[model samples]
Target chain A: MIKKIFSLIIIAGLLTVFIPIILNFSFQTDLPDVAKSYVEKGSKDLGAMNIVTAIIVTFRGLDTLGEVAVLFIAATGIAVLFRKNAINDKRPKQISKRDSSEILLTGIRLLAPVILIFGIYIFLNGHLSPGGGFQGGAVIATVVLLLFLSDSSYKINHKIFGFIESFSGVSYVIIGFLGLVLMGADNFLDNRILPLGEFGTILSAGAIPIIYTLVGLKVGTELASVLDNMKGDIE
Target chain B: MTDVFIIVLGLVMIVFAILALYLKDLVASVIAAGVLSLFASILYLIMQAPDVAMTEAAIGAGLLTMIFLLAIKKTKQIEDPND
Candidate 1:
């Protein structure tokens, strides 16, 4: 009775909120004039054909840095949770024959690579499109999850993840610092130092797409590793 | 028509999400939550933010649901009168 009442109240609240917001109905179809000019200029200045890439990597690189830290923290928290505790000392059970579905396994095997390739393509072409690090990273993690679902035998190496997590974190920071050294203190992750390639090309975004790719790899690997750790605990 | 379709879909998704939260069976609730997230991802796509949709599908539907299922497996389900 309580649960039902609570659910009704919540549903009513959402309906109330959504009705007003939907009625107010202004689609944000156009960027502000100043933002549009900046995007146009950024495409040229940052050597990125994709304005969003330039914005994420150069304009908001600090936010990306903090995001990486959050990933690290999440990984640490999961690791802590999975630590050998007597209270939660349930060992991972073997995958039962009944629980295994061949169709799911086969389909995942066929699709995982395609999804991963598509994710990489998105990351590589971020300088020329709307897709960037976060989008591509999430895509890659989806592939990892698919693999996990398909086969219980599969496992990720934790030592490698430790290296990857640390190296990527360090390199990202180092690259940002390098911009400081080369560009004479304009800003960290400033694109002035790298040669601006031809517009609309994959290589055009100077270091923006490169940084995004690294970030994608780091994020994808970290998330996959966390899920893998959870699997070990589950069994 | 497109706007109406979007609103209807959003309503459907919210309804499912509320059901998922209020459901008594933990496993059923988890699956319902996944369905809710999948619907929410579709809603994101309708909003012209495919990137957001992709993230929501991957993280909200995929990872979060998996995590919840694993958590449920580790712990015992609570008996509810509603069930």
Candidate 2:
């Protein structure tokens, strides 16, 4: 059944790719004039050097909220599956007992902090630059993965991770609601409610940077925790 | 320069994608698929679409590869091509 499904998918994908070429569909080269004008105007207003960041944080903030919720749901699903099997299964025995080279491990230790700092920097400047919460969070998790591989004994503090994950997730929503009351906005994540500081400043983009930072923290911590927890099971 | 790089990168990505599809070992195939995604990101950069490139790198190379590796660990390896 799986192989048949894969074959059908391949056939459908090939048909779509080939049919588009055979029919010669003309793709639009430019955005609508109204959208282009608004983009030009909004780029400056939003204080984002990267137009994509502006669209993500401001124009499409609600979609981002949904994406984060999806992440939370996935994490919960994994948690549920593991919790049910936790008591029945013994912790996986560590495989490949070969010791890592001290030099390689040292290099990883040195690099981990730099990667984490870079992720944080990206999250903090998300409103002003190209990087944002999701990217930064992934980067941070990459650092954790590096640590896990280079040092098998490395373990995450589950309590700290749980606290950080929950706090960041809750704070993200709270920040949005705060925007309603503090800025007297009618909606949850209205940027017009927050003080849009001087253009191009780190403090600019109203509540966007703060929100992204929270998202970054939540994602990074949760992903790292997931990967860390998987360590005991991959044997 | 960019156009030439893009053309070459696209070719490389296509090649890797084919390898990923045809390879016998599931783990190797997954890794090859990830390399294909990395090449796709390079093509995107050559085409001046960093945002898409970033997404491709993250979702395709990072997340997808990790998921495949986990799934492969859970399932029994295929012994015969038919089996």
- By lDDT, who's the top model here? 1
Ten-residue stretch with the least lDDT total in model 1 chain A = A86-95
TM-scores of chain A, one for each prediction: 0.79, 0.83
Highest DockQ against the true fold, candidate = 1
RMSD of each: 3.8, 3.3
- How well docked is model 2, in DockQ terms? 0.43
Query: Which parts of model 1 are misplaced by more than 4 Å?
Result: A1-30, A85-112, B77-79
lDDT per residue, candidate 2, A1-235, as tens digits? 9999999999999998999797887867999987796589566666666677777766777788888889888877777666636546566655677889999899998899998899899889876666788888888888888887888778888899899989988887777787678766566676655677888889886777888888899988878867765555545
Q: What ranges in model 2 sit over 4 Å off?
A: A1-22, A84-96, B1-4, B74-79
User: Candidate 1 at residue A96, lDDT?
Assistant: 64
Fnat computed for model 2: 0.13
Error of 1 at B42 (Å): 2.8
Candidate DockQ values, in order, are 0.53, 0.43
lDDT tens readout by residue for model 1, A62-88: 987997899889888887877766336
